[model samples]
Target: MPTGTPLAASRSTTERHDMTPSDPGARRAGADTTLVRHLNRRTVLTTLRSHPDITLSTLGSLTGLSRATLSAVLEELTERGLLEEHAPATGGSGRPARRYAFRATAGYVLGLHFTPNQVRAVVTDLEGQVVARERTEVPPSVPAPERLARARALAETATSQAGPVWSVGVATTGVVGPEGRVLRSSQIAGWTGLDLVGTVRGWYGRDAVAGNDGTLAALGEKWQGAARYADDVALILSGRPSGQGIVLGGRAHHGRSGAAAELGRLLQDQTWNAAAVLDEAGRTAQDVFRAASEGEEEASRLAAHLAHHTARAASVLVSVLDPQLVVIAGELTVGGRPFLEAVRLQLETMCINVPAVVLSELGDDAVPLGAARLALDALEEKEYALEG
Candidate 1:
């Protein structure tokens, strides 16, 4: 598995198919050529996305398509600028075969992570590279209109810098519906029912998808950060407004109403005041972490307080899911080694079987990066419907 390979399934599926008449979905009598051509287009596109350096003979052998079919599909894709044909290497004994590569920068996507405390935006190419980014802090008491205004500005600025975006992805607090609707949000004050999809869709005039911050952050970690190899993972998002992200069998679990990983409510009434713990003594979580890192006893105590509160919530999730790994992400990561150690200690005491506790390699940027992954998925056939 390369650092940014498309995914394991993409490669495995191609290996089993040899696109001949015997294939299950192969065209038959009275079949539509337009539909078949579109199907072929999608198949070639997906194969190259995962195996960009494939040669003609290898592609033919893997796809089970004849040379003439591949040539036609390749020509159509090349004309659209989604693929490129490289000059064949001269080292081979016979006539060298040309290589094919996916044009990762052919288009860009905008990924936004909006919360009551801050708004972050990023522009990623087709290959999930962050070419541009913008982030701003917001007061906890700010009204929804003010919060949205600030986020919209950041989105516009980042999009312009990264060129035209093909689609949009939004990450926010609360129970988000598939259409980008905010069904419920206690953290955002008055931001519920804002219809994020419609608003952001209008902003970029492009297709968009929205999801819970915790869920997306979890996905961001699985896709590009820690938990890449773990089949099941629990991500504890520690900050002023803490949440959770769950991954089961290598996919994000959103529950019945997108509240699967929202453990904030359970801890709010009993365990600890997350706001009081993360923001205290007029110091931000980052400042407290720096002070603790410098050996300040008071700051160290506060860091433990945060870990204790987070670990309690984590213990509950671990008992049920019993994931292979537990990841700590968000501003809490600024606390460094000591903070994570404290969380692991708490978990060890509470649960008979504690998973490996690790810090999110993507850190605070995890949410936005995951949002980019959402937009990238929309470009694939699985996420969209073909039109005649």
Candidate 2:
């Protein structure tokens, strides 16, 4: 899959008629239509989001729904303020069908990134476009509790700027346990066994979730950027100690203990910090990549070594997950073809039978966008929960 095609946009909405219709004594087609309505509405919205300005007939064809059913779905979505209709098409020889689009203000999501050096926040509308963003440096030595406090404060501030945010999501490094505890992450200071979701809930009094940075980046990319059409994607995040986020069947696979894909620590020898070697003198991942670009032989060598290790790790994951595509992002990919080509070469050599690999499209904002998507999803879940 190319990095530009979004997965949600390419989703097939054709109804499956595998189950034969029951007798009139059974549940009515009204019930089935209700399910179909919900499903088709989502499909319509997803399609409009990707295409931005599209016709209703086109939507009907894409969703494989009858024009009547598409009309009903669009009406329901529009009534709920989730979508909007534009003027009927004109000027062409034939009559123009009215176009439909997802309303940018239908809902809001908050994406927050807590890095060791900075706290980055973004607010996105339903279409995943950034509406508000803030980035500020923090003391890397701050205690975990203090850092969380600061992060929460920044989140609230960003939310205020975005106005009427529906939910909040956090992305960080380390292990986000199934129990919602962050265990043994080296991306941020004092972030071990931290109850991230609980902390956000307590602080903001709203729905929230936390995930590993690499995982979140992969999610964001899969949702709106590159690798969108892929059912299985491996995001190899190279920087200080490389890591990976694996998406299988459209959802991130965090594993049993939330430590599923830690690509950084996949070492040939147990005595090395892959991140440290890449970021000599304890520089940020960006600095190391920059050094390599400046023709620093050591930096170039370290970058190559990192790519080699990353490919080896990816091979291990491919052997198990058999991902459809691999996305190489973070500081290293910005090294342009040098880093991406090297990594691809290594992956070909390491896992000759694996899936295609590509560079990320969202750049450094992938994780933050993933966080925002998480926040929106949480908000929707809460709405359903309340209704139930």
Candidate 3:
């Protein structure tokens, strides 16, 4: 069968039967068949992506599909260049059965992080493996149009050798609406009212997605970082401006107006703004943590002060959402156990119930990685719609 041709089960049964053309039952059966085929194809693709190089027999067992159905699906995928068949490498086998793997290199996706000081881009394949990355420094004094142009150039450079890009995702520091508009951003001057999605789509000639950096960081952790196993998570992203992202029931919760967990905006009577505090000391959050790690009393004092504010912010989230895991992400967490332990201790004291608080494993790449994931998801949705 041709790659794009519908499977027998997905075709109209009325065409195969001698029933009248106006038979309602036959039409419903055909529609049901098409829906079932679409679902089965999605299931097979999902399973193959999760378990690459799986034997056909193993795939059938994992997907619970009969041999005939599995064979048809595999043939179609292979014909479409989305799946590759290979002989199993076993020394004792009489005849190695063919194994199948998703073709990760078939297409690529672009992810970008646009900030006041820097623009970073990453190219990933269908399997979410990083293919290429580029970073460009953008001085704060640069005009908004110039900064955006530079960001676009960086994205183009990053994906130059990655082949065809299926989708694009951009992560920015601000309140990003569902339609990809930057509603508000204090870090980047004149950033509000920017059509982030439109700009990115123009650059790549494909539909794009945009999201808040902190929210994407939470998704990054849930996708492949520290919070992978947690169903409900709150991510505290510490940087020049700290922010928070909440994930409940395995999805990022972007509240009304897409500003749900703006932890930096949370009111506190006596809060320690880590960025402001460190700036007053002529140091960065990383510098304070480094000094504390080296046993500097003054540095430890500053770290503790910052921890107090972080814990206080977390306590509010814990009290309200009661997440299963609280993740401390970004450059500050690079201080390792000292920073995490300090924050953990402070949270234990403030919260009525302390959840498992830990540090993010993805570090600086979290936002970009999460953006790539969003692009991948968009591609999957498009494919599913076409199939359906």
Per-candidate Cα lDDT values, in order, are 0.79, 0.72, 0.80
Enumerate residue pairs that collide in model 3. Answer: none
Worst 10 residues of 3 by lDDT: 4-13
Q: Estimate each model's TM-score.
A: 0.84, 0.74, 0.87
lDDT of 2 by residue, 47-141 (tens): 88788778877887787889887877666566556667789868888777777777777556789887778788888875677888877778778
Q: Can you tell me which runs of candidate 3 are displaced by over 4 Å?
A: 1-30, 88-96, 268-271, 293-297
Error of 3 at 324 (Å): 1.6
Question: Cα RMSD (Å) per model?
Answer: 6.5, 7.7, 3.9
Clashes of 3: 0
Alpha-carbon runs more than 4 Å astray in model 2: 1-80, 84-101, 186-190, 263-272, 279-300, 379-388
Better-scoring candidate (lDDT), 1 or 2: 1
Best candidate, lDDT? 3
**Winner of 2 and 3 under lDDT:** 3
**Over the stretch 90-179, how does candidate 3's per-residue lDDT look in tens digits?**
886598878889888777888898767888888888888888989998876787889988988888788887877778988988899999
State the TM-score for model 2: 0.74
Give candidate 1's TM-score.
Answer: 0.84
